[model samples]
Target: MAQTPLPDHPMRYALANELHARPFPVLKAPCRAMYLAIKKVENAAERDRSEDLAHLEALLDRYGASRPAPNADQYSGKLGRGFLKWEMHTEFVTYTLFATEPHSEPFSPDLFNLFPRDWLADAPGRIVTSCVVNVETVEPEDREDYMNRNFPGWFVPESLTASAVTEDTAVVVGDFQIDEHGHMRFAVLAHPDITDSRLGRIVQRVLEVETYKSMAMLTLPTARKVSGTVAHLDRELAENAAGMARESNEAAEVLRRLLTMTAEIEALSSATAFRFGAFEAYEAIVMHRISALRERRIGDHQLLSEFMMRRFDPAMRTCRSSKGRLAELSGRAERAANLLRTRVDVANQEQNVEILKAMDRRAALQLRLQETVEGLSVVAISYYAVNLAAGLLAPIGYKLGLDKTHVVALLTVPVVIAVWLGVRRLKHTLTDGEDGHG
Candidate 1:
């Protein structure tokens, strides 16, 4: 028997891996709490399965009619993201219930009968049967109790930590290291379950988790391009006070209109160059910032302030060679745009030449059509003249004891051959320019 390949738990993404550094998984709800197994999007069969989502109303109608024994009343969820997207703002009612007994037997945990552990035992997973929700959620006053419990992954028995406490919420953050054979796995846990309301705590926790994951997925290349453009603009203003970028804001109300006008290049004929140049500028900014940050020449909070200052400043604080290079580049860009236009015009002229040749061919054909028409007319006229002469001669033939029909036919043959040869001679003389008139 052939062996099956093992599945990768955390899936890899192609675009993210190339552009960013890692795969991005949405950590918000309905994406967060899913009933089905999370599979790689590249898998065709799994994608098809997600597409087959049933409406909740239809499922509710099928109890004795459409739904089976459990019915809509028994289930605690609405229709959600299957293999595809769940309609946004819609949610399935899902929770963990604590029960004294196991939920393996026929039971209703919703009736306040089962324990939280029972719900955990019945947790839904793709392949794993007992996949449980990470119950890191807790309340402010009860934070101490949760801390002591020392949950499996997020919290540990203790190292040095700083905690913020409030009447509504408490954020207890700490570092933990777990033994994985000889290697130790590290995790940063922020136990933010403490809140006046359990639901409020849950919302905050989920949102925080989502925000963290999103920030991690953000592509550095994209950020760099954005930063570089701002830096380049700032550098330009520094070089010349009268430059477009350095123009002082005397007309506050008309600033937006001016910006629109700036972008209005009667033609962005080479849009690719413009876009790529802008992106490259942003990339340069990112790199410059990274270098500054690394050297400790700038503070963490100073980046935004500096960027904004550069944007608002009428004149730059320092002038550099980059400004001169940018001026030269702008001139070069205009030249490139003009060259592209010229190339297009040259191509159009070449196309026009081809069209002229085609028209000349069409004119030759029309002239040939006229010649053909004249030849047919001559042949018809000559044939009738011959026949008339033959008919007049046939009377004599009949008188001489010869067939009149045979005499006329034989006379017509010579006339047709002579007409054909004469027409060919005429065509040659005219076309080859051998006529006396030519």
Candidate 2:
């Protein structure tokens, strides 16, 4: 009998498979590489992903290469003498092309011919970054001559940073400068005996360092733009907050302006939140990649990590400063708003108190007026009642042998007292009933 099998979760297989989705490319030394990153001008993450896939398929079709699966964000295919790798990220897509054969000259424009001219022009998004990376196998003895001749013409010596990385397994050099074609360049010289896979890993890390560094710097302009706006908002908030101390200040108007400022600040934060986060993450990746290099000094020149610290550190600090300022301003505005609301509430309460006092005075006047009216009503009713009694008793008095005027005179005092007592008793009864209900 077969053994009983255990059940698996619905997402178990997919989650496990996702871990191995993107693997490092296999590469050999003596190669030429081109890398391109594309991102839309607006809302790159929300752009039509289908367009990216179509662009890749079109390029693949040109070389009779295999197409990627449906909704695939990554693809690797063999070209004539080169291979192409495509990977999609949240805000951008990257294309890396590699060839085993080396280009004789350094930083040649012809190396990019691997990509179809028409296809590159018709790419779905604009090229956010692209670079020419050349990998060569240079022996330990010839390293000096290699740098002296080609390095000087292409890269500035003052700015060039070179290092021996991977436990001295390879030496990499890049000036981080844009060339005439508007593309950065990197050159790596691995030991001839190094394994192809190891070299591939090294090359990948170098490219990632460059790419992430560029991506991280994109936030600098945004930070600058936000800085100016934040400053203006800060000044306005300060003025309004100061106004709160004045007795004559318009509390409600100040609160309204604070609310409007709060809205603007919140909107700005929301709009730039993603960009700030992406910048930070990319900066971390760049630093991580540099550390992974495990670089040692090849000469007196600065290493990649040092160069980045010297140049990229300031831009990162600027971003951090702007982010911190925004936070502080938001907190200040919130406190000011709460204070203004409290003031408005207190003023309203005072006004309500005055209104209640006025109402009480009016109620006292109404009660006094009602008492005077009740007194008049009793006298008027007594007069009419006495006259009516006189008319009715006049005949009776004549029969009893008494005078009609005398009969009314005796009843007048009794009738008035009785009417006053009856009205008082009725008022008491109605007031007692209302009190019970209440």
Candidate 3:
């Protein structure tokens, strides 16, 4: 669509810019969805609002056709196309995310920074989208019928009664009845600020209201997959418990087989390669999918919180219910992801411990061998020193004493014994130090 300039009015700009916001809330890609709240109709083609009053009255049918139409100022047709027509109204809070639509890159939020918050949103990505509007020419009395017709068998967020939540009820007759414009309006009037996502919520609220006519289908394949994984894990836990409880001999055999299989699974999945393989990868995929789904709902909730004002409506209850459900689902997803993450951490730690133990054992063996070699070297040194001493004494003989041969032989024997003992002590000391250090 070609860009068109709006009137030079702050309110108009606010409505237009907010509705056409870019980079959507969740998807980083061009927006794939959007919502719009119809404000007042300005002017119809080729006629001033006043000049078109006759036709407008006929079209709106606010008062009976047999009845007289009210003054132009009192109604849209009587007043013209510029009537202040609105299903939702805002007094204090302004509209945000009034509409969303996908656009080309050159014009997409990805390319243009549309909001002040985009400074943060741009760092990541966003998804923006739009709906295909089905314009129909229908009678004015067909508003409610049209809603039920278009959205058949659909949940109406607006229809979420107080009794559904707290059994509360109030009977407030509508005083602001339709004038002579012959036009129809919504009975479920929600103040714009009252809604969580004033603009977007209106779209969804309308979706619910018109579900019988225009049902919006949602795709949750990823959500389903994660849910399936959770269920599967639940089953596995039950099976493990049942296997542990079995007492029959055959059951005992089965338990043994189960234990062996579990060990094999651990072995096969224990490798770094396997951790990076399909099983771990899919687990990660499921975690990511769950996170994304939760995030989308969270974004919706946040949008609602910001957009919703002081007005309390039935839609608010429905929105709260939806948000609560989303929170619960998110908690479940987080728990599952955390379980997998913890398992991964434990597996990695165990691998490291095993490696350290292996290194310890190998180092001990190496040190023992080294000590044996060093001990042998010390003994050889001591033996050689003893022989040298004996040789020196042999020349001197026993002249200094009584019997020279006996002195040389006995002296050598005592010297050899002392040296051998000293050498053994030195080897023992060396081995002790090595063992201590190792």
Q: Tens digits of per-residue lDDT for model 1 on 4-123? A: 586543543534444542112222211122221221222222243222232323433432233322222122322221111111111111221122222331222122222133333332
Q: What is residue 385's positional error in candidate 2, in angstroms?
A: 1.6
Report the Cα RMSD per candidate: 21.8, 2.4, 20.2
Put down candidate 2 lDDT per residue, 1-438, tens digits, no spaces. Answer: 124486677887778878877777778888878899988878887899999999999988888889999999788888768788899888888999888775677777675787888999999889878888888889988888887878888787878999999988889999998899888889998898989888888988998898888889989999999899999999999899889988864889989999999999999998988888889999999999999989999768899999999999899999988888888888889999998999999999999999999999999999999999999989999999999999999999989887888888978999999999999999999999999999
- The lDDT of each candidate is 0.36, 0.88, 0.34
Q: For model 2, what is the alpha-carbon lDDT of residue 195?
A: 91
Q: Write the per-residue lDDT of candidate 3 for residues 1-438, one digit (tens) a residue.
A: 326674465577657865654222221111122122221221111223332344334434533333124422222111121111211121000112322333432112221122224332321212111122211223334434544553332223332221100011110011112213221122222222232333233223322232211111111222333345445544554564465455433443444444544443334223212212322333333333223222112111121112222222233333333333434444443444444445446666877999999999999999999779766765676567666766677656645653545645566567666766786788789989999999
**Cand. 1 Cα-lDDT:** 0.36
Superposed by TM-score, candidate 1 places the C-alpha of residue 156 at a distance from the truth, in angstroms, of 8.9
In every candidate, how many clashes are there? 23, 0, 35
Q: Mark the 10 consecutive residues where model 1 has the least summed lDDT.
A: 82-91
Q: TM-scores for all candidates?
A: 0.25, 0.93, 0.30
> Which number leads on TM-score?
2
Q: What is the TM-score of candidate 1?
A: 0.25
In candidate 2, stretches whose alpha carbon ends up further than 4 angstroms from where it belongs are 1-4, 395-406, 425-438
